[model samples]
Structure formats: structure tokens, C-alpha cells
Target: MAVLTYREALNDALREEMERDDSIFIIGEEVGEYDGAYKVTKGLLDQFGEWRVRDAPIAELGFAGLGVGAAMAGLRPIVEFMTWNFALLAIDEVVNAAAKMFQMSGGQYNVPIVFRGPGGAALQLAAQHSQSPEPWYSYVPGLKVIAPATAKDAKGLLKSAVRDNDPVVFIESEIMYNLVRDEVPEEEYLTPIGKAEVKREGSDVTVVCHSKMVHQALAAARVLEKEDIDVEVLDLRTVRPLDVGAIVASVKKTNRAVVAEEGWPMCNVGAQVVDDIQREAFDSLDAPVARVNGLDVPMPYAKNLEKLATPNADHVAAAVRHVCYAD
Candidate 1:
């Protein structure tokens, strides 16, 4: 087993997939010559040549539309937006064209495309670049949305997304790209889509989270262990087609749950989880479900304010304690 940074894991997935299939190509701003805004695609251009690994102008909408057209024309394209914030410019391509292609054509055409890049708040990046759009993309019916939290998941999920026949939104958090390291399999592997992985097992409380918040939940679980409060952490690898069974079973065992998310509190991913739990696992719960979410405000430019706005270990721990000991 070799340890890899989140960025390297993603790059490895892209490189391996491209080598295995000639139809797959990567196109985005600075993805080739610049090696990506975060260097996730470094050295790819040289190995694959310009035809396969391309650099596009700073036009997300233009390149994204081109990628969609290419996918419909029998090529698999991995389009990278520098950050998800820039993806707003290409919303029509993603929400309408890519997501609706199969149904719109009555199954005559399939868009095997992957639109990915850093998502969520990056410190000091300010409001323009700091929002999390996973919830927005998950709302669309035909798209597969994946937000991987660990190095292993990053590689495995990206590989699966590339091979699928439908368009996928692969989200990676900028904060986790270089900070987290984990053991990744030497041989390539693809984690199944629509599955959840339980990072830690507990019998008292279930903590459902994804992406960077998964780490926060795990950290909080570690601290709660010292107080004899066991917390089960469920990493919902794919937000859409969420693994509701895994979450329900965990809640059944614990009889309590605290959903954690990095986005705003209103109408967020966490809200959806709580809704599903109440609908499917109502009798199994012993207390009201609690949600730990980022403050409902634009991410601030100041480091301190930004830190305060995002959900962290302390907030997670507090929520877990509240739910576990609820009267």
C-alpha cells in the first residue's frame, strides 16, 4: 500500500483511465501546459500529447460546451473547471445538455462526460470562489454526483465516474486536495457508485458526512470516544442516489444521528439526509436528528471569519454530544 495525496490520487485515476481508453481525453484551463490550477494533471500533457490532454482558454462555458458535444459524438471528455465557482458559467451545459441528453434523445445518445474540479470553501478565496454546489448538482435527475473525502475514495470514485455511460459531477474540495494523505491500493480499483463507506463504527450515534466534512466528523468521533460516546461515521461518497440503507442501519443501531455538511444550513445536503432518515428510520430513532452545517453566510475573505463560518470538529463534537445525551 502506498500513501498518496488527494491530488495525486485524482491525477493517477485520470492518467490510468486515459491510457486504458483512447476515447477518453482531458480538456480544461491550464490542464495541459499549466498542469492544472492545483497541479493535479501535471506531466499528463507530455505523456499523452496535446491531442489527448488539452489546455483551453479561460472560458468555462465555451470549453464545457465543446466537451459535451464531443461526448455526444462518441468521445469521453473530462472537463475541469478551475473551481466549482467558475462552473456557474457552464450551468446550462451541465444542467440541461449533459444531464438531459439521454432522456432528451429517448436513449439514442449518451454523454459519457466527467465535469470535475475543486469545490467548497478555500480559505481567503472570498465569496466568489467559496460556495459548495454539490447540493445544486444533486438536484438534477440524470447526473451522477460524487464528492470524495479521502485519498482512496478520490481515486476509486474518479475511475468509476470515467467509465460510466452518463455524465458525472466529480467534486473535490480544495482544502483536502493536498492536506489529507491515505494508503491507496497499488493496483487500480473503482469504488462502486451510490455506496457509502462507514469510516468508524459506533453504537450510540451516526454521523453522516461527505468530502471535507467527513474528516471533521471522524475527528470529532475520536474525541467523543474519550467520553465513552461512540459515534459511527458514514462517508456518503456519492451524494446523489445516496446510500440510504447504510444510513438507516447506522441510525437503527445508534438510535441517534447528526448530519454534517460543509454548505449552508438551508435546503442543503444535510437537510436531505435528515428528511430521508425521518421518513425511513423514524421508529428507530430515539431523538430528533441534528444537523451540523456551515453558517448561512457568504464565505469571508478574512481567515478567522472563514474558519468561523465553516463546520469544524468542535461543532461536530458538540452536535454529537447533544444528540447522544438528548433527554
Candidate 2:
């Protein structure tokens, strides 16, 4: 096992996958010469050359469409958006073209593409750049949404996304690029998409979250431990085709659930999880499922206000307490 930061694990995965597959290529702004906006593609350009590590113009819609076309033409393309906020410009391609190609073609074409980059707020990036748009893509039927929290999941799930025959939206947290670390397997591996991980086990309550919120939930679990409240932390590594079985199982075991996210509450990923719990594990639930989500208003620019807008460990803990009736 080798300890690595979230960005390093992603770089390793990209490098290894490109080495294994001749058809795989990366295309995005600053991906080649600049080594990715967050340096996740650092060293890849030199290793694979300009032909594979193609640098693209700052046109998300155009480049994203090109990636979709490339996928239709039998090449696997990884498209980086710099930040997911920029990806809003390319949603038509991602949602209309890439996602619908296989079905539109009547199963004759498969868009083996991965659209990735940092998501959610970082420091004082404010409203324009700090949105968590996972649910936007996850709502689509043909797209697979993945938001990995740890370095290991980031590496494994990315490799899997690269190999998947469908469109994938892989979101990473900008704040966690250098902050999150984990010991990854030295051997090649793939963490299957559509899975949830029980990061911490407890019998009193379950805290369901994805991406960076997993760490927040873990921290909240620690806080609850002092109060004799056992809190289970379940990371929904894959947002689309969510691991409903695992979530239901966790809720059944804990008897209470609190879903958390760095996104808004209305029609968000956590809202879906709340619905799932009520339907699949309604009888098992001891109390109503509660949600801790980013403020409905646009993300604030001030550091203190931003901290308050984004869901954190304190917010998660409070939600857990509400559901567990421990407050």
C-alpha cells in the first residue's frame, strides 16, 4: 500500500489506465501543458505525449462535444471541466448527446467517456464557482454520477469510469485535493460504481453522505461517540444507481438516518436518499430521516458565511441528534 493525496491517486489512476489502454486519451483546458487545473494530470502529458494528452481550448461545450464524438468513434476520452461550474456550459453535450447516444442509436453506440473535475466550494470561491452539481447529472437516466471522498476511492472509481461504456460524471472536492489522503493498493484495482461504503459502523444512527461530506460525517460520528450515541457513517460513493441496498441495510441496523451533503436541499441527492429510506426501510426507521444540506441561497463569499452555508460536521451532528432524539 502507498499513501497518497487525493490528487496523486487520481494522477496515478490516469497514468496507469492510459498505459493499459491505447485508445484512452485526455482532453480539456490546461490538461496537457498546465497538467490540469488542480495538477491531477501532472506528468501525464510528458508520459503519453501530445497526441494522447491533448490540450483543449477553454470551450467546455465544444470540447465536451468533441469527447462525445470521440467516444462514438471508438476512443475513450476523459474530459476535465476545470471546475464543475464551468461544466454547466456543456450540459447539453453531456446530457443530450453523450448520455443519449447509446439509446438514441438503439444500442449501437456506447459513449465510453469520463467527465471529471473538482466540485463544491473551496476557500472563498463564492457562488459562481462553488456549486455542487452532482445531483444535476445524477438526475439523468443514462449518466453515472460518482463523488469519491478518499484517495483510494478516487483512484479505483476513476479507473472504473475510464473503462465504463457509458457516460460518467466523476466529481471531486476542491478543498480535499491536497487535504484528503489514504493508503491505496499497490496492485491494480477497480472500485465498482454504484456502491456505498460503511465508513464507520454504529447501531444508534446512520449518517449518509457523499464526496467531502463523508469526512464531515465521520467527524460528526466522533462527536456523537462522546455522547454515547453510536453513529454509522455511510459514504454514497456513487450518486447515480445509488447503493440503495447498503443504505437500507445501514438504516435498518441503526434505526435512524441523517443524510448530509454540500448541495442545496431541494431535489438534491440527500432528498433522494431520504425518500429511499422512507420507502425501503420505513418500517425499520425509528424516527424521521433528517437532512443536513448547504443553504438554499447561493454560496456566500465571506469565509465565515461560506462556512455557515456549506454543511459541516456540526451540521451533520445536529441532524443525527435530531433523528436519534438524543439532543
Query: What are the per-residue Cα lDDT tens digits for candidate 2 across 1-327?
Result: 999999999999999999999999999999999888899999999999998998998899999999999999999999998999999999999999999999999999989999999999898998898899988999999999999999999999999999999999999988899999999999999999999999998999999999999999999989889999999999999999899999999998988999999998899999999999999999998899898999998988999998888888999899888987777
Q: If candidate 2 were superposed on the true structure by all CA atoms, what would the RMSD be?
A: 0.7
What does the lDDT come to for candidate 2?
0.93
lDDT of each: 0.93, 0.93
Question: TM-scores for all candidates?
Answer: 0.98, 0.99
Which residue pairs show backbone clashes in model 1? none
Cα lDDT tens digits, model 1, 1-327, are 999999999999999999999999999999998888899999999999998989999899999999999999999999999999999999999988999999999998999999999999877899999999999999899999999999999999999999999999999988898998999999979999899999999889999999999999999999999999999999999998889999998998889999999998888888889999999999998889989998999998998899899899999999998987732
How well does candidate 1 score on lDDT at residue 78? 97
For model 2, give the 10-residue run with minimal summed lDDT: 318-327
In the order shown, what is each candidate's alpha-carbon RMSD? 1.0, 0.7
lDDT of 1 at 203: 86
List where candidate 2 sits over 4 angstroms from the true fold.
none
